[model samples]
Target: MKKILVCGMSQNLGGVECFLMNYYRNINRNKVQFDFLCNSESCAFEEEIKHLGGKVYHVCARSKNIYQFYKDVNEFFSNHAKDYDGIWVNKCMLNNIEFIKYAKRYNIPKRIIHAHNSNNMENTIKGKLQGLLHYIHRRSIHKYATDFWACSRDAGSWAFPKEIMKGENFRIIHNAIDSEKFRYNVDTRELYRKRLGLTNSFVVGHVGRFQYQKNHEFLIDIFKSIYHKNSNAVLLLIGVGELEDKIKEKVHSLSLDNAVKFLGVRNDVAQLMQAMDVFVFPSLFEGLGIALIEAQVAGLPSFTSTNVVPQEAKITNLLHYINLNESAIAWADTIVDSQAIHRELYVQASMDYNIKSAASKLELHFSNICNK
Candidate 1:
């Protein structure tokens, strides 16, 4: 059996976390087991990983304490690196390549660096400083990483050298999910709608963290326009982040307190989608918008930023693209017009995004590596 140590789980159950969990849940554990290495101790899905027979190890945050972070990381690999056959280090940016660096230093037979974002969308000083290191380290990523994986072509270009990306050692492993899990359901939708006390309202939903990358302020502005056009319009903001309070304050200041609801970190996003009339995403950039894919699977009329979010995410006809520079009213107009779309529950996402098929292929990937 091949035990693959998976890194990159964070405090939030965000897109990258969901991406990893999707594969971990679908992949055959008997053949390829997974363990987690989290920078933060309080990671999402800790209980679930333990239930699946995986171990969880914690390391200090490099951003908070770089010296101790390096010492602890080195100690971890020194003591336990031999217990695993390979390391799968997923990243939104190349700010820290030490995970792969140490993995190779310890002679882990296979070191995989998976890219999950097309750009570094950090806004803070520390983040910006760390983000600059992405450029510094990316040039030499090929030196340590034996395998390269990305969510999309754009993300691959963002993370690795062009020649390495074109080689057999690389692959575009998508942020695939259980498509059927997100398929729209009428009964479940109605149940959640009533639970939220929105039995008679036009619901505009956005699922993502209230972070710079998600552009929640723009989403709120769009919702403000939607509210003005239709007083019954209600905006449902899902997920939590560092900027949640700021977003909530903005909603309040705009006199939208009564019209917006923050439904943080939900487990039943599919059921919640049934109650929504349209899905809006105006991200600054994305590797591949996993939330957009989920919205399309739920048969929602989804709107996303063109050029910023790669076209690879638009697998269904329901997806509509608008430039981010467009006015809030312009985006609102498009989303408002989509309210009449037949909210069906039988939509099928692209087969490539299905978790079972993706899991089978990943199993073979592990088998090939372990057998080598």
Candidate 2:
């Protein structure tokens, strides 16, 4: 079996984590096995990874202590780098390239740096510095990583050099999922709606961490406008982050504590999508909005920001793009009008995102690398 060490999985079940879990569950283990390496003690799908015969390792985060970070990574790679054929570094930013550096130092044949975000979401000084650090490390990535990959083209452009993005070593790996799991079903809608006590309400949903990237503050504002127009309209937020408490404060300050439900870190996201009348994703930027694609798969009418999200995300016509500069009331007006669930043509979903096909290609790629 071709064993590959997958890195950059954090504690949260965010887009990058989900992308890993989706493919991990489907890939043929006999042909290729994956062992995860995270900066934290454990990752979101720890139990599943262990159950599937995959191992999970932890290292200190570079942001917390640079010395310990280097020491831990060095010790780990020094002792265990030979256990795998390659190291796949899945990252949202290029703030740290030590994993690729160490992989190359250890002579791991295939070193991949996979990008998962288009840009930094924070507007603060720290965010700017992080962006600059990301820019500074792109050359290091180009020098050390044998393969360059991204969730989308936009993400590749953000984290890699132009030559790498256009070269043979680079590939755009679509964030494929089990689309059938998210396919709309009226029965599922009724089940979850009754369960959540939204039987007679218009449910507006969003699934993302309450971070600067996801823009939970603006989401709440738009929901406030939605509540004014129709009190029965409710917002379902699924995911929590450091900004969650602040967002809760904003929601309470707006007198919307009862109308918005904070459903954090759900395993049944597919069913949750069915209970929604609409999905709103106002992210400041994205490598690829996997949740938006899931919303589309659930056949939920979605509103998104086109300024940063790639056009490849327009898999279905149910997705609507809105400008960030527009007022919350304008967002509310558009969401309320366009989300009447008037999907005309059921387009065939037999496309590249099917998990089976992606797994096959990934396994083949890994197998080819090992054979060479």
Q: Which candidate is the best by TM-score?
A: 1
Model 1 weakest 10-residue run by lDDT = 342-351
Residue-by-residue lDDT tens digits, candidate 1, 1-372: 899999999888889998889999999999999999999968889999999999999999987898989999999999999999999999999988899999999999899999999888788997789789998889999899989999999999999888988899999887788888988878888898899988999999999987899999999999999999999999998899889999999999999999999988999887898888899999999999998988898888999999999889998899999999899999998888887778866778777899999999998998897677
What lDDT does candidate 1 reach at residue 46? Answer: 93
Mark the regions of model 1 whose C-alpha exceeds 4 Å error after superposition. Answer: none
In model 2, which regions exceed 4 Å deviation?
343-350
Clashes of each: 0, 0
lDDT scores of the candidates, listed in order: 0.90, 0.88
lDDT of 2 by residue, 302-341 (tens): 9999687888788888889999999999999999996556
In terms of lDDT, the poorest run of 10 residues in model 2 is 343-352
| TM-score computed on alpha carbons, candidate 2 | 0.96
Q: Candidate 1 — which pairs collide?
A: none
TM-scores, all models, native as reference: 0.97, 0.96
